[model samples]
Target: MKPEFENIPLIKNEEKKRFEIQYNGHFAFIDCKEMSRQIALIHTEAEPELSGTGAAAAVVEKTLMYIENSGKKLLPFCPYVFAFIKKHPEWKRIVDEKFEGYNQL
Candidate 1:
Protein backbone atom coordinates (compact mmCIF):
# COMPACT_ATOMS: atom_id res chain seq x y z
CA MET A 1 0.00 0.00 0.00
CA LYS A 2 1.09 3.56 -0.67
CA PRO A 3 1.81 5.75 2.32
CA GLU A 4 0.46 9.27 2.47
CA PHE A 5 2.94 11.92 3.54
CA GLU A 6 1.74 14.77 5.61
CA ASN A 7 2.18 18.30 4.32
CA ILE A 8 4.99 19.24 6.62
CA PRO A 9 6.60 22.67 6.39
CA LEU A 10 10.28 23.05 5.43
CA ILE A 11 12.59 25.67 6.80
CA LYS A 12 15.65 27.05 5.04
CA ASN A 13 17.77 27.68 8.05
CA GLU A 14 20.75 29.43 6.45
CA GLU A 15 22.46 29.92 9.77
CA LYS A 16 22.38 26.19 10.36
CA LYS A 17 23.33 25.41 6.78
CA ARG A 18 20.42 23.06 6.25
CA PHE A 19 16.84 22.71 5.13
CA GLU A 20 14.67 21.40 7.92
CA ILE A 21 11.31 19.82 8.55
CA GLN A 22 9.49 18.28 11.48
CA TYR A 23 8.06 14.84 10.94
CA ASN A 24 6.27 12.60 13.38
CA GLY A 25 7.37 14.88 16.18
CA HIS A 26 10.98 14.45 15.11
CA PHE A 27 13.32 16.66 13.13
CA ALA A 28 14.43 15.78 9.65
CA PHE A 29 16.93 17.77 7.61
CA ILE A 30 19.00 18.11 4.48
CA ASP A 31 22.45 19.49 5.13
CA CYS A 32 23.67 22.10 2.67
CA LYS A 33 26.26 24.73 1.98
CA GLU A 34 25.34 27.88 0.08
CA MET A 35 27.93 29.57 -2.03
CA SER A 36 27.91 32.67 -4.18
CA ARG A 37 26.24 31.04 -7.16
CA GLN A 38 25.31 27.58 -6.08
CA ILE A 39 24.05 25.55 -3.20
CA ALA A 40 25.57 22.18 -2.33
CA LEU A 41 23.26 19.54 -0.99
CA ILE A 42 25.60 17.64 1.32
CA HIS A 43 23.42 15.12 3.10
CA THR A 44 19.88 14.11 3.92
CA GLU A 45 18.32 12.44 6.93
CA ALA A 46 14.97 11.77 8.49
CA GLU A 47 14.08 10.44 11.91
CA PRO A 48 13.85 6.66 11.93
CA GLU A 49 10.14 6.81 12.60
CA LEU A 50 9.69 9.13 9.62
CA SER A 51 11.52 6.82 7.28
CA GLY A 52 9.51 5.61 4.27
CA THR A 53 7.02 8.39 4.95
CA GLY A 54 8.31 10.60 2.11
CA ALA A 55 9.84 13.24 4.35
CA ALA A 56 13.23 13.05 2.63
CA ALA A 57 11.69 13.30 -0.81
CA ALA A 58 9.54 16.20 0.26
CA VAL A 59 12.51 18.08 1.64
CA VAL A 60 14.56 17.49 -1.49
CA GLU A 61 11.71 18.48 -3.80
CA LYS A 62 11.05 21.71 -1.95
CA THR A 63 14.74 22.47 -1.71
CA LEU A 64 15.14 22.02 -5.44
CA MET A 65 12.17 24.27 -6.08
CA TYR A 66 13.59 26.91 -3.80
CA ILE A 67 16.95 26.74 -5.56
CA GLU A 68 15.23 27.04 -8.94
CA ASN A 69 13.19 30.03 -7.88
CA SER A 70 16.27 31.68 -6.43
CA GLY A 71 18.02 31.33 -9.80
CA LYS A 72 21.00 29.54 -8.33
CA LYS A 73 22.64 26.37 -9.55
CA LEU A 74 22.73 23.08 -7.64
CA LEU A 75 25.75 21.07 -6.58
CA PRO A 76 24.39 17.74 -5.50
CA PHE A 77 27.14 16.53 -3.21
CA CYS A 78 24.71 14.20 -1.55
CA PRO A 79 24.19 10.92 -3.37
CA TYR A 80 20.48 11.04 -2.63
CA VAL A 81 20.21 14.47 -4.19
CA PHE A 82 22.13 13.33 -7.21
CA ALA A 83 19.86 10.37 -7.62
CA PHE A 84 16.83 12.56 -7.27
CA ILE A 85 18.09 14.87 -10.02
CA LYS A 86 18.90 11.93 -12.23
CA LYS A 87 15.37 10.62 -11.85
CA HIS A 88 13.91 14.05 -12.60
CA PRO A 89 15.90 15.29 -15.57
CA GLU A 90 13.90 18.51 -15.61
CA TRP A 91 15.76 19.53 -12.48
CA LYS A 92 19.09 19.05 -14.22
CA ARG A 93 18.66 22.40 -15.89
CA ILE A 94 19.56 24.02 -12.61
CA VAL A 95 22.57 21.83 -11.94
CA ASP A 96 26.09 22.97 -12.55
CA GLU A 97 27.58 21.48 -15.68
CA LYS A 98 31.12 21.23 -14.34
CA PHE A 99 30.00 18.42 -12.11
CA GLU A 100 30.29 16.24 -15.17
CA GLY A 101 29.96 12.97 -13.34
CA TYR A 102 26.78 13.89 -11.53
CA ASN A 103 25.09 10.69 -12.59
CA GLN A 104 28.12 8.65 -11.50
CA LEU A 105 28.32 10.35 -8.14
Candidate 2:
Protein backbone atom coordinates (compact mmCIF):
# COMPACT_ATOMS: atom_id res chain seq x y z
CA MET A 1 0.00 0.00 0.00
CA LYS A 2 2.89 2.32 -0.73
CA PRO A 3 2.07 5.86 -1.81
CA GLU A 4 3.59 7.62 -4.74
CA PHE A 5 5.38 10.60 -3.21
CA GLU A 6 8.75 10.91 -4.86
CA ASN A 7 7.93 14.02 -6.89
CA ILE A 8 5.82 15.98 -4.48
CA PRO A 9 6.96 19.09 -2.66
CA LEU A 10 6.62 18.77 1.08
CA ILE A 11 6.44 22.18 2.72
CA LYS A 12 6.70 23.07 6.35
CA ASN A 13 4.20 25.89 6.51
CA GLU A 14 4.83 27.36 9.93
CA GLU A 15 2.30 30.13 9.47
CA LYS A 16 -0.48 27.54 9.37
CA LYS A 17 1.33 25.02 11.55
CA ARG A 18 1.30 22.19 9.06
CA PHE A 19 3.45 20.09 6.77
CA GLU A 20 1.70 20.11 3.43
CA ILE A 21 1.67 18.80 -0.06
CA GLN A 22 -0.14 21.17 -2.36
CA TYR A 23 -1.69 19.22 -5.16
CA ASN A 24 -3.96 20.30 -7.95
CA GLY A 25 -4.92 23.43 -6.03
CA HIS A 26 -5.68 21.61 -2.79
CA PHE A 27 -3.59 20.55 0.16
CA ALA A 28 -2.90 17.26 1.86
CA PHE A 29 -1.42 18.21 5.20
CA ILE A 30 -0.40 17.02 8.61
CA ASP A 31 -1.60 19.50 11.22
CA CYS A 32 0.85 19.80 14.07
CA LYS A 33 1.47 21.48 17.39
CA GLU A 34 4.77 22.02 19.16
CA MET A 35 5.35 20.63 22.62
CA SER A 36 8.73 21.63 23.95
CA ARG A 37 11.11 20.51 21.18
CA GLN A 38 8.77 17.79 19.91
CA ILE A 39 6.26 18.18 17.11
CA ALA A 40 2.97 16.52 17.81
CA LEU A 41 1.12 15.41 14.73
CA ILE A 42 -2.45 16.29 15.56
CA HIS A 43 -4.42 15.54 12.44
CA THR A 44 -4.27 14.60 8.81
CA GLU A 45 -6.48 15.71 5.97
CA ALA A 46 -6.80 15.83 2.24
CA GLU A 47 -9.36 17.54 0.06
CA PRO A 48 -12.33 15.41 -1.00
CA GLU A 49 -10.71 15.06 -4.38
CA LEU A 50 -7.64 13.51 -2.80
CA SER A 51 -9.45 11.10 -0.55
CA GLY A 52 -8.69 7.41 -1.06
CA THR A 53 -5.78 8.47 -3.21
CA GLY A 54 -2.93 7.39 -0.93
CA ALA A 55 -2.34 11.06 -0.10
CA ALA A 56 -2.40 10.37 3.60
CA ALA A 57 0.55 8.01 3.52
CA ALA A 58 2.35 10.26 1.10
CA VAL A 59 2.08 13.24 3.41
CA VAL A 60 3.02 11.19 6.46
CA GLU A 61 6.16 9.82 4.80
CA LYS A 62 7.34 13.28 3.80
CA THR A 63 6.65 14.73 7.22
CA LEU A 64 8.67 11.93 8.80
CA MET A 65 11.55 12.76 6.48
CA TYR A 66 11.26 16.42 7.43
CA ILE A 67 11.33 15.55 11.12
CA GLU A 68 14.30 13.27 10.69
CA ASN A 69 16.31 15.70 8.60
CA SER A 70 15.59 18.63 10.91
CA GLY A 71 16.81 16.67 13.95
CA LYS A 72 13.40 17.11 15.53
CA LYS A 73 11.43 14.55 17.47
CA LEU A 74 7.90 13.44 16.65
CA LEU A 75 4.86 12.80 18.81
CA PRO A 76 2.40 11.06 16.56
CA PHE A 77 -0.96 11.75 18.11
CA CYS A 78 -2.66 11.52 14.79
CA PRO A 79 -3.89 7.97 14.19
CA TYR A 80 -2.78 7.84 10.60
CA VAL A 81 0.73 8.80 11.59
CA PHE A 82 0.76 6.26 14.36
CA ALA A 83 -0.40 3.57 12.00
CA PHE A 84 2.11 4.59 9.40
CA ILE A 85 4.94 4.29 11.89
CA LYS A 86 3.61 1.02 13.13
CA LYS A 87 3.72 -0.27 9.60
CA HIS A 88 7.10 1.21 8.77
CA PRO A 89 9.03 0.60 11.92
CA GLU A 90 12.17 2.34 10.70
CA TRP A 91 10.52 5.69 11.22
CA LYS A 92 10.08 4.88 14.89
CA ARG A 93 13.56 6.22 15.54
CA ILE A 94 12.32 9.77 15.06
CA VAL A 95 9.56 9.41 17.59
CA ASP A 96 9.98 10.75 21.08
CA GLU A 97 10.44 7.85 23.46
CA LYS A 98 8.39 9.56 26.13
CA PHE A 99 5.26 9.62 24.04
CA GLU A 100 2.69 7.38 25.71
CA GLY A 101 1.98 5.70 22.39
CA TYR A 102 5.58 4.86 21.70
CA ASN A 103 5.26 1.46 23.36
CA GLN A 104 2.47 0.59 20.99
CA LEU A 105 4.71 1.25 18.02
Candidate 3:
Protein backbone atom coordinates (compact mmCIF):
# COMPACT_ATOMS: atom_id res chain seq x y z
CA MET A 1 0.00 0.00 0.00
CA LYS A 2 2.99 2.24 -0.28
CA PRO A 3 2.33 5.30 -2.36
CA GLU A 4 4.14 8.45 -3.38
CA PHE A 5 4.26 10.77 -0.40
CA GLU A 6 3.85 14.00 -2.30
CA ASN A 7 0.53 15.49 -3.31
CA ILE A 8 -1.38 13.01 -1.21
CA PRO A 9 -4.26 14.63 0.62
CA LEU A 10 -4.94 13.83 4.23
CA ILE A 11 -8.61 13.37 4.96
CA LYS A 12 -10.07 14.24 8.33
CA ASN A 13 -13.01 11.86 8.27
CA GLU A 14 -14.83 13.15 11.32
CA GLU A 15 -17.57 10.56 11.17
CA LYS A 16 -14.97 7.83 10.87
CA LYS A 17 -12.97 9.47 13.66
CA ARG A 18 -9.65 9.32 11.87
CA PHE A 19 -7.27 11.08 9.58
CA GLU A 20 -6.70 9.04 6.45
CA ILE A 21 -4.41 8.72 3.47
CA GLN A 22 -5.35 6.40 0.66
CA TYR A 23 -2.67 4.03 -0.59
CA ASN A 24 -2.73 1.18 -3.04
CA GLY A 25 -6.51 1.36 -2.83
CA HIS A 26 -6.31 0.96 0.92
CA PHE A 27 -6.37 3.52 3.69
CA ALA A 28 -3.61 4.29 6.16
CA PHE A 29 -4.92 6.28 9.08
CA ILE A 30 -4.49 7.82 12.45
CA ASP A 31 -7.41 7.01 14.69
CA CYS A 32 -8.26 10.15 16.61
CA LYS A 33 -10.69 11.71 19.02
CA GLU A 34 -11.62 15.35 18.64
CA MET A 35 -12.47 16.98 21.92
CA SER A 36 -12.04 20.29 23.66
CA ARG A 37 -10.58 21.78 20.51
CA GLN A 38 -7.90 19.15 20.50
CA ILE A 39 -7.19 16.17 18.27
CA ALA A 40 -6.13 13.24 20.38
CA LEU A 41 -4.13 10.90 18.17
CA ILE A 42 -5.04 7.54 19.56
CA HIS A 43 -3.38 5.11 17.17
CA THR A 44 -1.62 4.90 13.85
CA GLU A 45 -1.72 2.02 11.40
CA ALA A 46 -1.09 1.36 7.76
CA GLU A 47 -1.89 -1.64 5.64
CA PRO A 48 0.78 -4.32 5.99
CA GLU A 49 1.81 -3.53 2.46
CA LEU A 50 2.77 -0.03 3.50
CA SER A 51 4.84 -1.19 6.42
CA GLY A 52 8.48 -0.08 6.37
CA THR A 53 7.74 2.32 3.54
CA GLY A 54 7.51 5.28 5.94
CA ALA A 55 4.01 5.96 4.68
CA ALA A 56 2.63 6.14 8.18
CA ALA A 57 5.14 8.79 9.09
CA ALA A 58 4.00 10.89 6.17
CA VAL A 59 0.40 10.53 7.30
CA VAL A 60 1.35 11.62 10.79
CA GLU A 61 3.22 14.62 9.47
CA LYS A 62 0.26 15.67 7.36
CA THR A 63 -2.09 15.16 10.26
CA LEU A 64 0.09 17.38 12.43
CA MET A 65 0.06 20.02 9.77
CA TYR A 66 -3.71 19.85 9.65
CA ILE A 67 -3.90 20.28 13.40
CA GLU A 68 -1.44 23.15 13.41
CA ASN A 69 -2.90 24.97 10.44
CA SER A 70 -6.44 24.53 11.71
CA GLY A 71 -5.42 25.98 15.07
CA LYS A 72 -6.31 22.76 16.83
CA LYS A 73 -4.22 21.63 19.76
CA LEU A 74 -2.86 18.06 19.89
CA LEU A 75 -3.02 15.24 22.34
CA PRO A 76 -0.60 12.68 21.00
CA PHE A 77 -2.02 9.69 22.76
CA CYS A 78 -0.55 7.29 20.25
CA PRO A 79 3.04 6.32 20.89
CA TYR A 80 3.91 6.78 17.22
CA VAL A 81 2.49 10.30 17.20
CA PHE A 82 4.24 11.04 20.49
CA ALA A 83 7.54 9.81 19.08
CA PHE A 84 7.01 11.82 15.94
CA ILE A 85 6.55 14.98 18.01
CA LYS A 86 9.49 14.03 20.19
CA LYS A 87 11.71 13.78 17.13
CA HIS A 88 10.38 16.93 15.51
CA PRO A 89 10.01 19.07 18.58
CA GLU A 90 8.88 21.98 16.43
CA TRP A 91 5.56 20.21 16.10
CA LYS A 92 5.28 20.36 19.85
CA ARG A 93 3.96 23.85 19.40
CA ILE A 94 0.63 22.29 18.41
CA VAL A 95 0.50 20.20 21.54
CA ASP A 96 -0.76 21.25 24.88
CA GLU A 97 2.46 21.31 26.84
CA LYS A 98 0.48 21.11 30.03
CA PHE A 99 -0.97 17.73 29.12
CA GLU A 100 -0.09 14.76 31.23
CA GLY A 101 2.91 12.85 29.81
CA TYR A 102 3.72 15.71 27.46
CA ASN A 103 6.99 16.15 29.34
CA GLN A 104 7.88 12.55 28.55
CA LEU A 105 7.63 13.38 24.89
Candidate 4:
Protein backbone atom coordinates (compact mmCIF):
# COMPACT_ATOMS: atom_id res chain seq x y z
CA MET A 1 0.00 0.00 0.00
CA LYS A 2 1.12 3.53 -0.61
CA PRO A 3 1.13 6.20 2.03
CA GLU A 4 -0.61 9.50 1.46
CA PHE A 5 1.65 12.44 0.73
CA GLU A 6 0.39 15.93 1.44
CA ASN A 7 0.78 18.68 -1.12
CA ILE A 8 2.98 21.46 0.12
CA PRO A 9 4.55 24.41 -1.69
CA LEU A 10 8.32 24.55 -1.50
CA ILE A 11 10.25 27.76 -2.07
CA LYS A 12 13.66 27.28 -3.61
CA ASN A 13 16.51 29.52 -2.53
CA GLU A 14 19.65 28.32 -4.23
CA GLU A 15 21.76 31.19 -2.97
CA LYS A 16 21.15 30.30 0.67
CA LYS A 17 22.22 26.74 0.06
CA ARG A 18 18.69 25.69 0.95
CA PHE A 19 15.31 25.01 -0.52
CA GLU A 20 12.56 26.37 1.72
CA ILE A 21 9.01 25.12 1.69
CA GLN A 22 6.78 27.40 3.66
CA TYR A 23 3.29 27.03 5.05
CA ASN A 24 1.35 29.67 6.96
CA GLY A 25 4.59 31.62 7.08
CA HIS A 26 6.40 28.74 8.79
CA PHE A 27 8.92 26.74 6.81
CA ALA A 28 11.27 23.84 6.56
CA PHE A 29 14.67 24.18 4.94
CA ILE A 30 16.81 21.65 3.10
CA ASP A 31 20.45 22.65 3.15
CA CYS A 32 22.32 21.37 0.16
CA LYS A 33 26.05 20.97 0.14
CA GLU A 34 28.22 19.86 -2.71
CA MET A 35 28.96 16.66 -0.83
CA SER A 36 25.80 15.94 1.17
CA ARG A 37 22.24 17.04 1.93
CA GLN A 38 20.87 18.21 5.26
CA ILE A 39 17.32 19.00 6.38
CA ALA A 40 16.19 21.25 9.21
CA LEU A 41 12.79 22.14 10.66
CA ILE A 42 12.94 25.82 11.55
CA HIS A 43 10.52 28.61 12.51
CA THR A 44 10.95 32.37 12.59
CA GLU A 45 9.82 35.08 15.02
CA ALA A 46 7.56 37.22 12.93
CA GLU A 47 3.86 38.13 12.83
CA PRO A 48 3.17 34.45 13.27
CA GLU A 49 5.68 32.95 15.60
CA LEU A 50 6.11 29.32 14.69
CA SER A 51 8.74 27.95 16.98
CA GLY A 52 8.72 24.14 16.41
CA THR A 53 5.90 23.05 14.26
CA GLY A 54 7.53 19.91 12.92
CA ALA A 55 8.37 21.83 9.75
CA ALA A 56 11.31 19.48 9.32
CA ALA A 57 8.98 16.88 7.94
CA ALA A 58 8.13 19.19 5.08
CA VAL A 59 11.82 19.80 4.50
CA VAL A 60 12.45 16.09 4.28
CA GLU A 61 9.60 15.71 1.85
CA LYS A 62 10.84 18.56 -0.31
CA THR A 63 14.36 17.21 -0.32
CA LEU A 64 13.16 13.80 -1.36
CA MET A 65 11.07 15.37 -4.13
CA TYR A 66 14.04 17.35 -5.37
CA ILE A 67 16.28 14.30 -5.32
CA GLU A 68 13.74 12.23 -7.20
CA ASN A 69 13.04 14.93 -9.74
CA SER A 70 16.70 15.71 -10.34
CA GLY A 71 18.02 12.16 -10.23
CA LYS A 72 20.24 13.13 -7.35
CA LYS A 73 21.11 11.05 -4.31
CA LEU A 74 20.51 12.08 -0.72
CA LEU A 75 23.06 11.78 2.03
CA PRO A 76 21.08 12.89 5.06
CA PHE A 77 23.47 13.88 7.81
CA CYS A 78 20.78 15.52 9.90
CA PRO A 79 19.17 13.35 12.54
CA TYR A 80 15.74 14.71 11.72
CA VAL A 81 16.33 13.86 8.08
CA PHE A 82 17.57 10.40 8.96
CA ALA A 83 14.44 9.76 10.96
CA PHE A 84 12.20 11.11 8.22
CA ILE A 85 13.66 8.65 5.74
CA LYS A 86 13.39 5.85 8.23
CA LYS A 87 9.72 6.55 8.80
CA HIS A 88 8.86 7.03 5.14
CA PRO A 89 9.81 3.91 3.22
CA GLU A 90 8.44 5.35 -0.02
CA TRP A 91 11.22 7.93 -0.13
CA LYS A 92 14.00 5.43 0.30
CA ARG A 93 14.90 5.27 -3.38
CA ILE A 94 16.20 8.81 -3.30
CA VAL A 95 18.46 8.11 -0.38
CA ASP A 96 22.04 7.35 -1.19
CA GLU A 97 22.94 3.67 -1.10
CA LYS A 98 25.82 4.62 1.16
CA PHE A 99 23.23 5.84 3.65
CA GLU A 100 21.77 2.41 4.24
CA GLY A 101 22.92 2.66 7.82
CA TYR A 102 20.77 5.74 8.37
CA ASN A 103 18.20 3.52 10.01
CA GLN A 104 20.52 3.15 12.97
CA LEU A 105 20.59 6.89 13.49
Error of 4 at 95 (Å): 1.3
Which residue runs of candidate 4 sit more than 4 Å off their true CA positions?
A: 1-8, 35-48, 51-54, 100-105
State the number of backbone clashes in model 3. 0
* Per-residue lDDT of candidate 2, residues 1-105 (tens digit): 344567888998989999999767878999999766788999999988988788878889989988888788999999989998999999999999999988999
After superposition, candidate 3 runs with Cα above 4 Å error: 1-3
TM per prediction? 0.86, 0.90, 0.91, 0.66
Candidate with the larger lDDT of 2 and 4:
2
lDDT of each: 0.82, 0.88, 0.87, 0.58
| Candidate 4: clashing residue pairs, number | 0
List model 3 lDDT by residue over 1-105, tens digit each.
134776889998979899999877877899999886888999999999987777899899999998988888999989999998899888888898777987887
Q: How accurate is candidate 3 locally (lDDT)?
A: 0.87
Cα displacement (Å) at residue 55, model 3: 1.0
Instruction: Estimate, for each residue in 1-105, the C-alpha lDDT of model 4 and write its tens digit.
Output: 112225666666768767666667555566666443533323211123434555656556766776778766777666667667678777767766666474563
Clashes of 1: 0
- Candidate 1's TM-score reads 0.86
The TM-score of predicted model 3 comes to: 0.91
What's the alpha carbon RMSD for model 1? 2.7
